[model samples]
Target: MRIRAAILAALLWVGPAAAQSDPAEAARHAAQLLEQAAEALNGAEGARDRVRALTEIIRAYEAGLAATRDGMRKAAIREAQLTAELRAREKEVSRLLGALQTIETTSPPLLMLHPSGPLGAARAGMMLADVTPALNARAQDLAKDLEDVRTLRQLQQAAADSLAEGLAGVQKARTELSKAIADRTDLPRRFTEDPIRTAILVSSTETLEAFASGLSEIAAGEIAATNADVSALKGQIELPAQGVVLRRAGEADAAGIRREGMILGTRPRAIVTSPTAATIRYRGPLLDLGNVVILEPQPDLLFVFSGLQEVYGEPGQVIPAGSPVGLMPGASPEIGAILSTSGEGTGTDRSETLYIEVREGGRPVNPEKWFRTDKDG
Candidate 1:
């Protein structure tokens, strides 16, 4: 076949275009993960190790939500591209349909019979044979494009419900994790915090450096020491949160205020974790930096994270690596906001800012040197 060859050519034309990316497939996978997380959340209540189960569920929800957001954004883009292409080819498609309709309605005998002579008829038949395949290919392409537009529209409509469910699930998981952390009492403590001394230090300190330098004064008794050393992982440590670097070390912000640390742009209520096993040197409000968690992974090295709505764990407690430290401040975006911003590509999803500082021997250093900052959020 001629028909088979024409069909193959039509398929070849559509194959690369459809193979570019499948946002609907990605969204479906994310939706499945979110569904699994919801099921895990139900079972977590009755699990023997509720805290650990809840933590995994929360992490799953966070991952699923992030993927879902990305999928929706991509879907929006793909839909726009397809819509624009269809509009651009509107006249060509109309002509193609009209020609196809004429071919279909006209008798084959009439099409082959040219008016001029036998030679003209023979020439017309050869031309018709050549043009038929091209017309069929165009028709196939037009049909595929129309089908893709319909599928993308349907996917976008379904995405709203999925996003809403995922947002609610993640929020519930976060709340439960917070409560579980508060009730937890089995973690090893390095030292008991003196509230009076901490209050005094908070009042007296004007900058984060001063508060960090006086951390020792806030301890009530002899500090339980450990030989935990993460210097070997100096440049291998991951960032404590899922975000993109907004401002690098010593980069000035819009207000022209520069700090010796990095600013990360994170999604609202994104989970922040300890990059490595570290002791909680300090946690809570300090100066104007909002809720903060200062982790001392090594004796003289400290990782300071600020701009949290809620902080976990008490001061002077040794927490394991990847333990939840806090949550970024801001309400999660609603479904409407997500859909409206999906096509904007303005990074409105990452609306919260997290301030991170690495202090080595009580002096600020570029966090990029300590953490792997090459990957995008």
Candidate 2:
């Protein structure tokens, strides 16, 4: 079967090889994920909750693309290994081929005859029985390796189209999600925003610390009450975005300016979500931080995310866990760029950064302590 067909089959059934660590199995799994994402995109158009549907679609695409990239990287490495092994065994392969060819061409009765007579012939026959199987097994292994190389090549080539399709689908989903969020109503609000007070505070604050300190001053009405407590989930909460840590808290940048927060390197337009159920304390451009979203998941605890191109939700609104907050800045890479870098297995493609800061009692704390930082993208 072709790579694409095999991927579809794997998706429909849990084959024994699906659980293996083989490169081919991994590639097949990746392809299956990409196909599922495509299906999600197709189903999203008719979904009643457009915002939710689009958010899921975008996430699906991201996961599928990431898996595909990993698969391609493994496939490339595996192919190179197979090629190198074949090259190293060239002499052995040639000798085996020559022996097999000689055996095929020689008459059976003549091959059985020996100059040393009947006893010698019987000994020769026993040796041939053992040796013939070894040669055939070696030949089978070599053929399988050659075939695998071809399959890996096809998989990589086929991935180019799947990656392009996934990229476009995600972009479209993001656009739709933005529109949906803009048109959305009925989200629960903890308090009404006082824009005049917010503007005054923005004008008066010189730093993020000062701005965050005065967040309560921007609330105009009586705040709604909530019993949500995420204190037990501390140090277990997932990162709000899919990316690897670029800089840790207190790490100095090239300009020698140290930050209290950590920077995450993410792919362009990666979706940022609420790590847990939280109330939006603030969301917008703040203090040269580009678009920002501040969440209060527990009393006196704040989670700040910045460097987004488009922010979602309104100030004082309560959002559920995994809610889409915003998207990272920059356009998605073109198909050519993706395919070219698929095998490099580096984060060079992650061109955007999201800054994350956790605050306890209005003081900046290390975000790594609050979030699970074990995964690298």
Candidate 3:
């Protein structure tokens, strides 16, 4: 489509004699491109797919939870069965004990009355006759049934215990699975992929102080300005609430003015081996840069700040770069720059690091060229 638009534009540029020189052709081509873009966007259905995937994941979790609950219910049923069996066995044992007790008491009375006078003997005989072998067999059968019930109850109890353990295990597994999904959704895939997070972690006050000391050592003497041609411009350009400026320090050009300042980095105090004073500057509108400074040092170039704080040094202050200029009294809203290293993301991607720009020939160069790798301070 772009090729087609270019061809059409080229044909139209061929002077007024061509019939294809209509201005409406460009609008028609734009509409076509818009239609194609819309079609491409519709093909992926990203939002709809994301929602559907999330819903499916939730449904999977619900299913797992339900299965675990059903397992628990089965365990409860098995427990009830075991309990009932135990009760039945207990009742049977009680009946057998009662029968045994009655047998023991009657047997004693029969033996005590044995060998008495003719009438007493006959009465004892009648009593012994009442206690038949059939009763003994019946008592043995009752005892056997009680033992069988006890054995069955024991087996059921074991089965119930196993079921309960299985249910608990399933429940625990389901809970862990749910937590895993939640964690996957919340946590990023790679920790180091986020430079901002890494910076935040390393930006502790003590670390900053140590790095500041390192900067002081580097900035002690006149550091060799590699791209001095671009870094020498000086002017307070007014930018909007969300705006950024990228410049370099070097020889003055037709449009660039020469300005010098101290080198100040992110140290609240001096470290063991490094100096403390730094050069800071302001570049934007009054509302944006209440206090701003650019600290230029060789090999390890940086930008310093005192955002929304009072400015201590004037534009031409000849103080050393690391000298205390001012303090950042309030938070500074980030300004996004349209540079390669600016990274790609939404509003949250804007970083809090001071904007560093390298310049030569009064034009901006990439700051990454002077980036330092030392962090041992």
Can you give the TM-score per candidate against the true fold?
0.90, 0.85, 0.20
Measured over all alpha carbons after superposition, the RMSD of each candidate to the real structure, in angstroms, is 8.0, 5.0, 30.9
Name the runs in model 3 displaced over 4 angstroms: 1-290, 294-308, 329-353, 373-377
Off by over 4 Å in 2: 1-20, 45-48, 113-127, 194-196, 220-228, 253-256, 340-345
Per-residue accuracy of model 1 over 64-101 as CA lDDT, tens digit each: 77767666676777888889999999999888889889
- In angstroms, the error of model 3 at 40 is 65
Task: Report how far off residue 212 is in candidate 3 (Å).
Answer: 26
Best by TM-score: 1
On residues 1-377, what C-alpha lDDT tens digit does candidate 3 reach at each position? 33234223332332233223222232233223333323332332344333223222222222222222222233333445656765777876576667667657776556556556768878866865676565577677766655644554453344334334433432343333333333333221111123343233334424332433333232223333343222232232111111122223343535766323111222111111001222232222222333344344322444443242333333222233223333223232221121112232232222222223343233344333433312210
**Residue-pair clashes per candidate:** 0, 0, 36
Query: What is the C-alpha lDDT profile of model 2 across 225-269, one tens digit per residue?
Result: 777889888789988887889899999999999999999999888
Error of 2 at 270 (Å): 1.0
Using TM-score as the yardstick, the better of models 1 and 3 is 1
